[model samples]
Target: MARTVRFHEIGGPEVMRLEDLETGEPGPGEVRIRVEAIGVNRAEALFRSGEYIEPVKRLPARLGAEAAGVVEAVGPGVSGFAKGQPVSSVPAFSQNDYGVYAERAIVPAAALLRRPDGVDAVSGAAVWMPYLTAYGALVEVGGMRAGDVVALNAASSGVGLAAIHTANRVGATPIAVTRTRAKRERLLEEGAAEVIVSDEEDVPVRLLALTGGRGAEYAFDAVAGPGVTDLARAVAPGGTLLLYGALSGRPTPYPGFDLGMPALNVRTYTVLETTRDPGRLRRAEAFVVSGLRAGVFRAVVDRLFPLEDVVGAHRHMESGARFGKIVVTVTG
Candidate 1:
């Protein structure tokens, strides 16, 4: 029997239950892993609370999409990966189709990535969502280049920090935006070229001044709330504003006044676009691997919880105080 995290109803973290589940052998083109570490993301919290993009269709649904472990079984037609090889899970399918918060789980063969050297199980679990999301949005879609100025708000989360690292690696100037000055020093220490405190300063004004009268070339936002228009306004002409997450639980409103500039592009993005496409997925993997080998790509683990403490883990994530990714260690 395998221990897995499942929720019968969609509501709060307390709805989650760790149960002894019977995990069967892998099917065709599938791989089974003995999970060691699970990445805890806000998306899972949103998923369990019935606030995600899709509704739960079945009861006792599984949770999580990121983890690292050694392969325990490989089904027919699977090549390259052998038994006992170290691997990590990636988001290739919807959470409703598969999840990783378990001592053992089976996933599609294509959704696994080899763990880079020197990266432990916890680090491997933490790297997937943050780096891929930033890479897909900044490098692949936005066409970020050296010396380009990119502004990122909510600059303290894992994705936010990953964006800063991405900009640095590409020789771009990353302007980190925050609601307060609490994480300013840390952001700078982590390679942010400039830091803007949204509460104490005028964002657009400071952005323009920092860019020599021209606004930022691009702005990456995770908080889609009333302040979206302001962020859009801070973009230079022909620039793009990528809204990736709605942390504020409010729709990103496109006010009438800001629509005057036709060159400014406002769009949303997802990592699945790169994860599912073979060529793009390979490129993304290579990029992440190079960064890791060069010490440029890193994961800051905020805390670790035992698999059964998933409810408390979600509660801590809701507190908005963690500075990096949280991992669930499955010692079983």
Candidate 2:
């Protein structure tokens, strides 16, 4: 039997229970992996609390989508993978269909990526989701180019830091926005050209002044609420505002009409748009792999928790005090 994390009811981190479960064989197009590390994300917290975009389809549901481990077995019709090979699982599958928070777990083959040499379990587990989301939205879909300026919020989170690196890699400038000064220096050290303290200063005004009144070419917003209106004011003419997350837990309103309807374009995006597509995923993988090999990218982990302390890990993530990814390590 494998120790797996599951929730019987929708609630806080206290509701999650690590119970012994049968480690079953993989079905068709699936692979069973011996998980070594799991990446904790806000999505898991939202899922457990019944506030995610995708609802809990049934009771006693599993709770993770990102992990790094060694392959133990492959189901029928699966190729390009073998037993004992190192691999990392990305957030490419639905949590309702599968989860990786277990000593042994079965995940779809499509979600597996061969972990590169020199990448340990914690680094592998922490890299994919955040990098893919930033690279896919900014580089692949947004067509971000050199000399462009991108304003992104949630600067201390994993994805936010990745966005800073991605922008710098492409010769663009990344302006990071956070709620307080506690994380300003760290954000600057992470390659952000400028850090905007949203609570201390006016975001749109700072963005406008920094861009010499042209505004940023793109505003990548994670917290979507009434703040979209303020961010809209900082978008250059014909620029796009990409809303990729809803961390605000409130309603969001389109700001075009409210701001006199300037020549602005607004759109929503998610990493799934790239991960779910074969062509896009391939391109993104190549780009990120090149960056990693060249030392242009790195995984930033804030804290590590043992498998038995998954509840404490979730509590830390919800505390809003972390600066990077929270990883959970599994042991025999």
Candidate 3:
């Protein structure tokens, strides 16, 4: 029997319960994994709280998206993966729900990616979602190119860090925006060409100055609402504003005239849209794996908690004290 975390109802972290269940062998084109680490993302919180666009099915839904483990069993028709091979997967939403928080999980072969040699389970689990989102937004959707100036809001987040690293890899200058002044030096060290303390500095003014009065060529905004308007203002002529997240829990108001008149493109993207396309997913995974293997990108784990203490982990993530990814270590 596999031990898994299940939630009977949508509400606070207290609603989550740990239970024991029998896990069957992987079906065709699937693989069973002995889960080591599971990533805790904001999407999980939204799903648990019933705030996400997609509705959670019935009671006792398992919760999680990405995980890292060693392959325990490879189902029929699965090739190239051996027993005990280290792997990571972003399971399909339906199966992903209760499985990733369990001691063992079954996932499709297509979702499976081998972990890089030196990457640990925790870091490996952290890599897929954020980096994939970053890659899709910046390169695939935004069409970021060399010498482009990119501005990323919530620049201390996992996705933000991924954006900075992606921009660096593409030979673009990444300007990171953060509300906290303390994270400036760390952002710089992480490949941000410049860091803007949004709460302290005039964002539009500083952005214009940084771009030599031209403004950033691309803006990645996670914090929506009034801040998005400012972000649109800082976009250079013919620039793109990719709004991927709404951390503020409010509606984003945009000045349609400003965007339309100057031919500024305002695009909203979700990881699902990008990953749903097999070819895009393949490209994203390949690039991310290569970056991990080459040490061009590193997963930042703020803290790890036992699966039993998931409530505490969720609270910590909600507290906004964490600067990077938070993970849960699932024990067998």
Candidate 4:
């Protein structure tokens, strides 16, 4: 039997429960992995709370889309991966369809990628969603380029830090924004050219000056609140403001007002848009793997919890007190 985390209701962290289930063989084009590390993402929390893009259609739903472990067996019609292969899920499918927060999981073989050398199960479980989300927003959709300047809001989150690393990879400059000054210095030390304490600094004023009178070409925001007004103002003429999340729990109030002024483009960006496309997915995978092999991309683990501590892990992610990825290690 494999221990799995499943939620029978849509509410707080308490809704989750750990249970044992009989392990099954992989089906055609599928691979069964004995999970070693599970990544804790905000998406799961939102999904459990029934606030995600697609509402939870059923109950007793499993949660998680990223994990790293050894491939115990491969199903027919699958190639390239065999028994004892180290691999990780790429978040290419819905969590409802393929949740990896279990001691073992049956995942589509196409969604698996070999763990890059030097990246252990802990860090391997941490990279997929964060890096891919940043890549989709900055490169695939935003068309970020060399020397381009980007403003990253909620700069202390995993995606925020991944944006910092992605920007560095393409020779772009990143301005990290946090709600307070507590994470400013730490963000700088992690490759941000500049840091903005959103509560203390004028985003537009500082951004314009930092870019030498020209605002950032890309404003990657995870906070979709009233501050978006300033973020819109902080974009260069015809620049793009890509909003990805609404952690503030407040409605965004900017595009309607900033419609005509700077002629900016405000749009919603999601990792799914990129991961679902084959070409873009391949590009993202290659880029991230190359960066990891080159030691340019890094997965910073804030904390690791045993599978039994799933509730506390979810609580920590919701508390906004973490600086990097939270991982849950599984033992069977």
Q: What is the TM-score of each candidate against the true structure?
A: 0.98, 0.99, 0.94, 0.96
Order of candidate numbers by TM-score, starting with the best = 2, 1, 4, 3
Clashes of each: 0, 0, 3, 0
Q: List the residue pairs that clash in candidate 2.
A: none
User: Stretches of candidate 3 above 4 Å error?
Assistant: 91-98, 258-260
Cα RMSD of predicted structure 2: 0.7
Q: State the lDDT of candidate 1 residue by residue for 208-281, as single tens digits.
A: 99999788888998998988888877788888899889998886787436667557888888778888988888
Candidate 2 lDDT by residue in tens digits, 1-332: 99999999999999999999998999999999999999999889999999998999999999999999999999999999999999999888888999999999999999899999888999999998899999999999899999999999998999999999999999999999999999999999999999999999999999999999999999999999999999999999999899989989789999999999899999898878988898998898888888899998988999999999999999999898999899999998
- Tell me the tens digit of each residue's lDDT in model 4 across 1-332: 99988999999999999999876999999999999999998889999999888788778899888899999999999999989989988777887777898999999998888898888999989998899999988998889989899999889888999999999999999999888988889999999999988789888898998998888999998988887887888788888999999987888886746546667888998888877787988899988988888888889889999999999999999888999899999987
Give the C-alpha miss distance for residue 322 in model 3, angstroms: 1.1
Candidate 3 lDDT by residue in tens digits, 155-274:
888899999999998899999999978899999999999999988999989999999999899999888887787778889988998988889899888755745667588888888766
Name the weakest run of 10 consecutive residues (lDDT summed) in model 2: 269-278
Report the number of the highest-lDDT candidate: 2
C-alpha RMSD between model 1 and the true structure: 1.1
Q: Arrange candidates by lDDT, highest first: which order?
A: 2, 1, 4, 3
